[model samples]
Target: MELTNIGTVRDILGRHGFNFSKGLGQNFIINPDICPKIAENGNAKKGYGVLEIGTGIGVLTKELALRADRVAAVEIDTRLLPILDETLADFDNVKIYNEDVMKADLRGIIEKEFAGLRCAVCANLPYYITSPVIMLLLESRLPIDSITVMVQKEAAQRLCAAVGTRESGAITVGVNYYGTVKQLFGVSRGSFMPSPNVDSAVIRIDLNKKSELTEEQEKFFFRVVKAGFSQRRKTMANSIASLMGIGKSAVYSVLSELGLPEAARIEQLSMEQLMKFSVMLMEQTKE
Candidate 1:
């Protein structure tokens, strides 16, 4: 079946009585070139297992199945299950689960489904849940090598943006803490079956094999980072103090000890500086 062919896609979904759900952010890719690139760059290969978050008409899922040793996907919309069954029939390696990726047992899935194969993730993520999904995958600390997903172009910029830059936000800091992200390619808005208002881009995040911080430290670091970015216009010290209920003087003292100005903003601190600041603040709070 030509999954990317618009007519073929419509015929299949029509036969299955599938209607796109606006709330679900359903936008199936109609571009033939996009899925193959995602599969290839997403580390779907002979010895790899792939966990796909959303299988839109099985376009990307088929591509992943073709390359990987095994494919397990979670699709929230039950309406697409029959459509996926029809589209992915020939691939014995693909397993489709009707569950929310957010609440799904990802670690259990990785352990049971992947076994000896190196695991990776690939998805055509819904724009509304993009940040939450990415953060969930990262914070889960699953045994996945990388995550490759197509998201809104603006979101792609922030996700792949350099930390401490103007384009960076709290999520940027969080993403950088866990892995390195890079934009793979851009897909125009017209590439989808229904087409979306914004263009999209595929980005890859290679997870760090080992993290330097302990679990408690990691949690506190993100709390500080989130607080610092909560109010963009406020100084980092002021924002962190206000949100975290720490005295402003304490935050200022930590910044001063790190050779940073009291007026420093979240975007002004490099990842290294931010970590050092977090550690210092933790000590200050303990005192």
Candidate 2:
């Protein structure tokens, strides 16, 4: 079955009574070249199991199944279950779970489904939930090797942005804290059946096996980061003081100790600076 064929796709969807849901951000990829690349770069191979977040008529899901040892997809839209069944009927290695990826027991699923095989994640993510989903996958410390996803081009820039740069956001820091991200490729807006307004890009995040901070310190670091970026225009000292309920003087003192100007904005602080600043501020909080 040519999943990307407009006639085939329409017939399949029509037969299954499927209608695109804007609220769900349903944009099925019609580009034949994209899914194979996503599957390959995602590390879907003989010894690897692939966990897919969304099954858009089993398009990418089918590609992952062809390459990976096992393919498990968590799709929130139950309306696509019957469609997926028809689409993916030939693939015994693919399992479909009708559950929200955010709320699903991903760790449990990985353990049960992948067993001895190494695991990776591949998805054509909905633009609205991109950051939250990526953060969840990273923060949960899943045993997956890498996450390859297609997101809005603008979001791709933010996600893969350098932590201390203007394009960076809280998500950039959060993502970099857990993994190394790289933009893979770009896909035009016209690549989908119901094309999105914005172009999209594929990016990969290779999980870091080692964490620089302990559990307590890690939590504190994120807390400080959240506060730092809450008001991007404000100086880091001011933003941190305001959102974290710490005195501005104390924040200024920390900044001075770290050799950062009191006027330094959060975007201007490097990752090393942020780490040092977070630790020092955490110590002061305990005092």
Candidate 3:
């Protein structure tokens, strides 16, 4: 049975007396094609451990359990526990935890249960918590090899945005620092039950082994990036000045020394340039 087929999903939910909750972002994918595609993009193969968030009705969870060696799904809603049990009963390797993923100790879980394996994270992220969830996975020490997630289309654009684009923001730069993000495919709003107002896109993030800077340098770079976008309409120099509580003239001097345009907006600077500017700011602060 196709996972995305409304009839099948509805039947499963109805049988279990399940009611979709908007607070949980319970717009389940009704398309079978998207489920396996998400697994494929996540590189979920036999012998790989997969971490899935929000296993509502086990639509995507079923696919992950089928393709991956072991699947650990963290679901927030306790009501879905029995539903997941019914759907995933045949797979012994699959474990469903009733907890908020944001608060769950994923690293400890992975270390204890799935030690010494390359893990991949796959999810149809809740629209409300998409950014935080993705950031949480990326920053975890659990050794995630890659991530494939279905997110709101606009958020996907921002995640994959180029430096010069309007969609570029602090999150874009942050995402770039950890990995390369690419939009794989798009799904119509109608493809979901209790359809969302906007469409969604599948985004694949490939973690990079070589980081451009040391940990300290990256932290400082993010501080500057966040300051730059703190006031989107202001020039980078002005924004940085406001954020740092420094004079605009000093900020302009830093920009001039770095050869960046005085009129440049926060969205105009590349990641490398932002790092350079951040380093300059730190040096000046020390002086």
**How do the residues 2-87 of candidate 3 rate in per-residue lDDT, one tens digit apiece?**
56777887888898888989888889887668888999889789768998999978888888888888888899999889877777
How far off is residue 254 in model 1, in Å? Answer: 0.9
The sequence of per-residue lDDT tens digits that candidate 1 reaches over residues 154-175 is 9999998888898999889878
> Which candidate has the top score in TM-score?
2
Worst 10 residues of 1 by lDDT: 208-217
lDDT of each: 0.91, 0.92, 0.83
Give the TM-score of each candidate: 0.98, 0.98, 0.94
- Which pairs in model 1 have colliding backbones? none
RMSD of each: 0.9, 0.8, 1.7
Candidate 2 accuracy as lDDT: 0.92
Tell how far residue 124 is off in model 3, in angstroms. 0.2
Model 1 ranges with Cα > 4 A deviation: none
Candidate 2, superposed: residue stretches over 4 Å from native: none
What clash count does candidate 2 reach? Answer: 0
